[model samples]
Target: MAKMRACRACHYLTTENMCPNCKSTNLSTSYTGIVVVLPGRKKGEDPRKGSYVASRLNIEKPGKYALKVR
Candidate 1:
């Protein structure tokens, strides 16, 4: 499997060279911690509105994310 890389701009985890979340090309292999934001219960609902982690991290989408990237 391809090793996942974390986006420096948004901290999102992806295998692709570009971050699908923010389209930032700056990615890092040196990262610690992982957070998976699940989708909201209702359709078209924002997860950040209900998820504490998502809200604290300012994440708007549901996906795997790195807690810290270097």
Candidate 2:
């Protein structure tokens, strides 16, 4: 298993040393909860169009995100 880390800038969860989305090295190992966004086009299923979850969490990409950061 890979150790997950949260991006300090975007709170994105990943196991790599740098965030693939933001390409930032600022990551935290201590975080809680996870949010996964499924990609599709529906009435309210599009994250790129700015869903409530994506807006509230400041997430632009559809992937695993950290709900809480410490």
Candidate 3:
């Protein structure tokens, strides 16, 4: 498996030299906590509508994001 790097700017994880989400080259190999946002919702509940972490992190796009980037 390839090592995944997390972008410092957007906190998006990728295996390339740059982040595909925000096109940021400032990536870090050392990071902690990973959050995966699902694209679907169960029943009538919205997934990201009032998510505490998502809103606090300022994540609009649904995908894998690092909680802390170093």
lDDT of each: 0.95, 0.84, 0.83
Best by TM-score: 1
lDDT of 3 by residue, 9-67 (tens): 99998899999989989999999999886554655444457577777787777778888
- The runs of at least 3 residues in candidate 3 whose Cα sits more than 4 Å from the true structure, single-residue gaps closed, are 40-50
- Cα lDDT for residue 27, model 2? 97
For candidate 3, what is the TM-score?
0.81
Please give, for residues 1-70, the per-residue lDDT of candidate 2 as tens digits: 9989999888988999999989999999999999887664664455856577877886767889999988
- Model 2: how far is 36 from its true place, Å? 0.6
Top of the candidates by lDDT: 1
Q: How many steric overlaps are in each model, in order?
A: 0, 0, 0
For model 2, the stretches where C-alpha displacement exceeds 4 angstroms are 42-50
Q: How far does residue 15 in candidate 2 sit from its true spot (Å)?
A: 0.7
6 in model 2: Cα distance from truth in Å? 0.6
